[model samples]
Target: MSLSLLTPLGHSNVAELIARRTLTAVFQPIVNFDGGTILGYEGLIRGPAGSALEAPGALFAQAAREGLSVALEHAAARTCVAAFASLGCEGKLFLNFSAEALVALGETRDRTVAWLNEHGLGVDRVVLELTEQCQIADVARFVTAVGALRESGIQFALDDYGTANASMNLWVRLQPDVVKIDRFFIDDIANDPLKFEAVRAMQHFAGASGARLVAEGIENAADLIVVRDMGIALGQGFFIGRPDARASREFAQGAREALDAGHIAVFPGATRTPVAASPSGGMAAAKMIVAAPAVPKSATNNDVLELFNRLPNLHAVAVVEHERPLALINRRSFMDRYALPYHRELFGKRPCMLFANASPVIIEKSMTVEQMAKLLASDDQRYLADGFVITDEERYVGLGTGESLVRAVTEVRIEAARYANPLTFLPGNIPISSHIARLVEHRAEFYACYVDLNHFKPFNDRYGYWQGDEVLKFAAAVLADVCDPTRDFLGHVGGDDFLVLFQSDDWLERAMRALRAVDTGALRFYADEDRAAGGIHGEDRRGNPAFFSFVTMAIGCVRVSPDTRGGLPYGSEEIASVAALAKHRAKQEASGFFVIDLDEGAAQLHLHEAPGAAMPQRASALS
Candidate 1:
């Protein structure tokens, strides 16, 4: 509600205005960005079309100047609720209450309840919004009053967040269900880095405190994306909706399409497919099962000899018994034995399985590329000649040539490791960026999280550079420990910043838990004095005595296309842009908290644990 200049119209006029009941309530829709659906309607009080009190600012200011603010607000609530119900609004009815009236809600709540019932509106449908514009005298009492009203099932929302009236202390005292970020920080958020950071920090604070965040006054598509990327739970402004006496019961098509962009089957005429631009780790295994030539156990030894000559490239042959691999016949071993005097005459007519090696190495078709490397490393001559048999559920599928396996492993490892950081051995910038492109191309849903330290630079300056290296190593280990091995991708985006692309659906909670643990454990790494002081003491670049807080990390998370959330992008570049914004927000907040940018993709969630958590990680492929 925008306030206007104090009216010269006096006390008598304020009283006269309330008696006339010349006010209108227009509702502004608060939308759920994830679904492009209306979460609720906030009732904004406005005066008559062209009167002196047409502006809410003028009406409230004149009333406050006359000590009749509470009386005026009570009247406004009655009028607003009645109009809201009559318009057939479908969501919660959010009514604004002045600080003056909040303290005196004894009769006001009952009167508002009566208006709601009369209009067929339930108390549960009402959300009493208190803005920070008014100086809340006695926060404890205010919190109590708001809490006391909850017994009737009415929820409370704190508005104009970040202002003095809605400070952290107030937030703790009240524990409001929702905090609407002030529009001051939302306007042109995409272009303004500072505002973007502020909004993201607020979003993280809200998530940690268990409050839903609402960004008010999103003006355009870019601003909407910025707010959505910060994972703001709800939004209000011209972009989503506008204030009108008649509130809309449903969202328009354009808004719906934008919100559902990421998961839909067809986007801009392109088919959405599972992200597979280039498979890595476990993902590569699915494509590695090449067909192999096999024959029944009854086939004569002559059949094997003839097969080798027919397909010269055949590395080895699997002797099959009832569709299961019974043994492997090495071309050289079989041919060498036959070359010895009369060997072919003695065995050429016998069953091939009888002469074949019975204990050849075998691997599952689903085994990861990394796992394959390990299995292949376990043997030499036996596997070298006979190669390895690929199976599906114990049934023979194909043969993996030793040379092919070695080449494949080397190529996969090289591709994955080339851009890895030397110190931590985590995939570096280039690979992370490429992975994002793969996500967009495949239309796979994954969480891309950017992680970094808060006070590392200062701590390093205070101590030595090597200490910083130890800290980086520790962080890398912790990340490896927490992230799912088979599904998640971890990369070192240079000093202090890392990226984790999560293939699981419940990554938000997992990310939160893991980072929280890191923050708790990181404290001991500091010097004795710094540990006691809660942070390192050092000189700033400008030579000032800077007290650096204990190391805390920030994780900025954004979900990639998998469920067609409107947060959908043309490619990795857009997601990177958003991640950069999220990273900035995380650094500013620096609480070792996870800030997830949520969209409709959250609805299609199916969290899967990553494969091979216990196995040692193969640090990036080749580099």
Candidate 2:
């Protein structure tokens, strides 16, 4: 069992050493950002004593060329599983498996399961890390095999996400439990704005997909801090712990200590963490209730003019009956609809009198400015109201003017822009959560659509960064235009992604058409050379030839209905959950658009059958 004999003598010797159980396993601990707890360790395999296969990378490479990669992989898996069992580590164990080797795993499935069960490890605790570098020729079979193992508690992960062209597609198709972001992106996230924005967007996408993001190749405290701030749940790098079998126990203890000490920074990249203002510390509470000012339905144009003169801050006058808001009269409406000479005569019969057609923005007493901003941004100009009448149920509580909403929304947008994906200028999780809460309080019917650009990165890679920016801006404009002021809302959730809302189901179809129209027109910006080639040029990691395909979008829609059972309205969190589920379903379908109705009390998923329905249409010649 000398190491020299096992040293790459030939494929036979390597296999013999593996069969003899001479291979050793090393464990590298993956740690949490803030807690610094050992989340898991990636089990790295080493060669037998004195072997030329001393370098793990070279060892695996040589095995692949020699056609013994599968056997070697199995041996490594068994060794790692055994070592994990002996160490009594509760965290997950990540074991690398080449796609080429996974195909053959079917033959050894039973054996592998038995061995894992024989040890303390179960399928759930062991994560199979599939490298994207290898081509997966048969995805269906691969998925079936992995899915079966997953049912037995085994989970799969895509290693080196964003490093390969096929990785993004594989991630969507395979839907792994974890995605290990490549080191190239994480290495300088804190210092490089471009890389930071890209990774942040990736993190948002991962969260939406219900997958965990692990930052790999973290070598310094700075890198660890940056990754943590970016909201990466799991991290593996030399700073946390290097790979070693006997060191696992020590590493776990150290990780726990670090967490307790708060030695790790949560978000190194955040300029500032948000702090809520103390309610009692802000504006003084009114000692007495002031009667809300009112405007009579019979008020003349002269009366309207007098009211504006009396109250300079007068945003709108409410017409009420028995404490119910009947209509809202704005200063501009009266001035535009009535003449000074007819003021008295028009008093009782003016067309500008508060009517059902007059748009009104309603708000609850507890609403924050951030929530109101999202509502304002979702609509077109016609639906713009001066302010919302704050109410509790049917009774008026107070007033929320556009000035107040403007100030509130500005703060929120600034905060959002800090962490938002810069390239796309979309709000991240922080704002989305607030917007959902506000929507729920309103008891409004709104549709939440999870928008994803299909084959975007490939397009980005083919086109330069400038072209990629154009595509993202184009999508943003499309979303803004498609959203109807009377019934819809839209927000940029992050890169190549958007969250759109509509009060009417029919509006979803309309919005889709508009999105398709805009996307089609936007594609023309690509130079003729790139269009003729059907791809753009870029440099690969190794500075090799890189060509990427065109971009398209996939949408997942979910509708949130008003809850009438309780006197209070439904909340945004519920709607967001439903929307996320629908998006997942849409991604699963061949079509790009999928809709789900959560109001049905169960998941009812529907997919739009039109191919490229989300794609923009060709423009007609005019002028």
Candidate 3:
């Protein structure tokens, strides 16, 4: 077992060494971050017994220097396949390859697949990981080779994506099924905003390109928390399991043992173990359960009014008969429909206004406090019930409360806030988009305004981000004040950009006035010296120096008309575009307000026309 004995003496000596079995392979498991399930293992090649080379990296490096890189790769593949056969683990096996070896051998992939098939390992179980340091010469050839292997069920993953140049472009073009982000990027993503932003951008890109992102080289629990919060679905790192042939079996066994013991095992170098709950706690131990509220389908409006009078804070009443659910009637709907004059005749009849879809959004009895919280965080207030009705196969079981759901959602919000931007305190783009879509469906005559701060970058560069941030907060407060929850909405769409939805046209004028007043008042933050010496202070993107002055915002407003008009007055996609155009026009004209005219055949027309002009005016104004 001396190191000198394993040295390759010559071609003949190496051939004899291969014949006599000189190398071995080690397997490491890659685990998912969310549930700690084993995704697969990377098969790391090692030196043979009695070899000068101590590890695979050294052995492969030496092999390449000796012009035997192709031979070494073939030997590694064979050794890895042989070792994989004995494990009987049903997961992918990742094998490494140098780009040079792939191009040089020219026909290595086909032969390797055939050899693997000859052994017990099939192409479906194999994953070829393109090594980080390899320089791909012929991308087309490499793609062709990998594509051929993939047709046989082999998968390709681009390793160390963030570490190399043009990696993103390569990934986009090759369209690999998986892209393993370099550990450097994942290590500090939780604390570093730039790193987190980069991960988010990469994740979005991967999703768009139909590729899965795998964060590799995670080393601790802290890192695991960051990746999971970032919503990464697949992960691989030393914190999960080290590279070893028995790692998967060890993980499976440990997981099963943990399940049986009703406890999870936490240790360094150990596979992930699930924390199982004891079955002894039954219905009596449940925190909250959905109970079918006693609602009569044949009850009159007076009956519902009596029920509400009895329970003034009623969230919703489920209309159910026997064990089956019929509909959900909320307090608001009852008031809106039955409180009208001449609506008394419909009182004794069944309420056709029930939301039957509410059943799908119901909470189950077995749901934990944590799970219940997430459902309520994004849920609408109108859907809240005094408690969720617990049911088993149409049989009414128990009840859950709005208070409990609120507590759960609060916890989820807190957990979500850990990763949310502190300045905006919004759920970022992913959750923000969902909120916008929900607002759109409300179908009100709401004005969605895209707010952009003019010359704010110059201010940031001249004064500092601290003051610039104050200005941003001031703008946010102004917008928030103008937005009425009962009639409007406000959202911070990242730096210096805000969105406000106004249900009332009067509020639009108020919002503009409030923003102007805030901007004017915020000017006092700067010193008297700098205030008087206002001029361009920073360079624009084109490298030209630009002047800095008082802050101003160009607001673009698009009215999302009610869908009841049969068809949209304007295309939804053109709303933001037209608003942006109007805002740009305002910016160019140095005007405080501008409106995007959505009227048909109004091209080249001014938004505000003179009295008695071609455009029609209000009949009251004419009088």
Candidate 4:
């Protein structure tokens, strides 16, 4: 009934409304795509019931006409702060600030500060959103004012960016902590290349500015997916949420989970790949540690015993102290003691800490499965009996079983070795194909660099197979040295051919670095006279001596974007065909350099070499 008074045409005096503080607040959640968590809520203002100025836009416009813009804005701010306090939000609050109000505050934000303090909200909890809708005449003064707020522990975000204030100049001058990409840029972004490019550029710009990017007005699941693929951390809009007065924390369906998983291969007619969680001995511990919330150390022995009995399938329950795992209580061990005479009467009421294994195997989520296994190797009995605790930054996140770790690490390591090249030991055909398929399923970005050693066979004919093997090993080491084990994949496609799957943002850098390292390392393999002469005499296919420059490396780089696929969406044969074409173009260069195929339409045609590469050396390293 009260909401009925907030009609767009409800007549009210703007000045009188400001004086009476007749306004209300609504909240919209700002979700974190990477973490699958509610990052914060953005508080929007509404006018009082039954006022012509009830609509927030109308209210602000009326106040500006009445020369009370600053007063009305402050009134709205106070109302939102009070409203947020009543609900007890768990995250930060993003509030929209008009240019007029900020200019009027000058260098003093006493009003906003006092309201924040009065509401028990920290300066860190407040983020003032400066939208481009309010043009700034003196950009410098605005920057200084925003800087002052930042110095006081308040954060600033450039709202409605990529529209009127899309200028690089504005971004440089304001240097906000976040850029909320205007909704138009995000609308239908999944199908629009221009919008995708714009957001992609902004992503790089955000990285350079040390600011995060938020995609606002994500109205659909498909658009939200594209926004996430472009690597925006914070997301908003009707799809993620709508403005609501009740401060509800719910978000749009499938958006949060899909974003956090960082992959969506919902291509029609595509079968789901085997997505295994070899979390142990892998990346963060949170990946593998199943969430069985820990029991406090102070929990009575009876509590632990009852938990064990209640959950018949339970293997163990960790005794945690302030989020840290202090001990473990195994079902079998506890039952054995409970079966003894008066065991319950003797220790049922005592703290579980006393009966718990004070030194139960504890493992952090950050530790690689390799690291956990190495640590577990110290105690064979414990490895078989008690599992490990997975902690994030020293706080328990979940539990890790030794059996799970062993199974995951052993399978991955053995599979890797089985398919590895006999000499280089880099992954071979099976692992390489599986890796690409898996990454395709997850919709990850990777650069597939197919490297072919030019003149390698000829060099072997002249220098013997053993010498050729030496050069191959040398090249492999150089490639391995450039790979970031944590984020990238390196494989040997047998002989003088190698494949690198780059998953990091700096993939181009790492790829270029590898190519450069190989070029330099190849030179060392040649004898002094050959290195200086820049050519070696080798027998060609015609059995005639040919002048071959020191072994050169040629790389064909294929960009596998999240939304990338050509004629054959999930076909391994198509990948090889495209790779062969890229390598053919790469080998055309006079000197060894890598070239990238940017066209998504024709994978077989129009492979373009990446710019900024060094001058091509004139030698058929493959000849």
lDDT against the true structure, per candidate, is: 0.69, 0.62, 0.59, 0.70
lDDT of 4 by residue, 43-78 (tens): 888887776777877887887676666566666666
> In model 2, what is the error at residue 397, expressed in angstroms?
60
State the lDDT at 583 in candidate 3.
Answer: 53
Q: Candidate 3 lDDT (Cα, whole model)?
A: 0.59
What are the runs in model 1 whose C-alpha is more than 4 Å off?
A: 1-11, 107-112, 252-254, 263-623
lDDT of 1 by residue, 1-623 (tens): 11121123344766677667678888888899875778889988888789888899998898778877777777787778778877877889888876656656633456545656778998888887777765777766766667667766787788888765677876776677888888888887665534554566677778788988888887776566546644576888887777888887765555555455442111110100111111344434446565878988889999999998998877789988777888898888787888899878888898887679888888877676656677665745577667878887789988877777777777765665445666776666666677667667756678778787878888777667898889888888888777654346777777887777777556777788768777887887776877777776778779888778777778767655555455455456556545655666566663645354544213212121135334221122112
The full ranking of all candidates by lDDT, starting with the best, is: 4, 1, 2, 3
- Between candidates 2 and 3, name the one with more favorable TM-score: 2
Model 3 clash tally, residue pairs: 23
Per-residue lDDT, model 4, residue 589, is 79
Q: Over the stretch 355-420, how does candidate 2's per-residue lDDT look in tens digits?
A: 323546665554444344457657543324555566655676555556555555555545545445
Question: Which prediction has the highest TM-score against the true structure?
Answer: 1
**RMSD of every prediction:** 27.1, 30.0, 26.6, 18.1
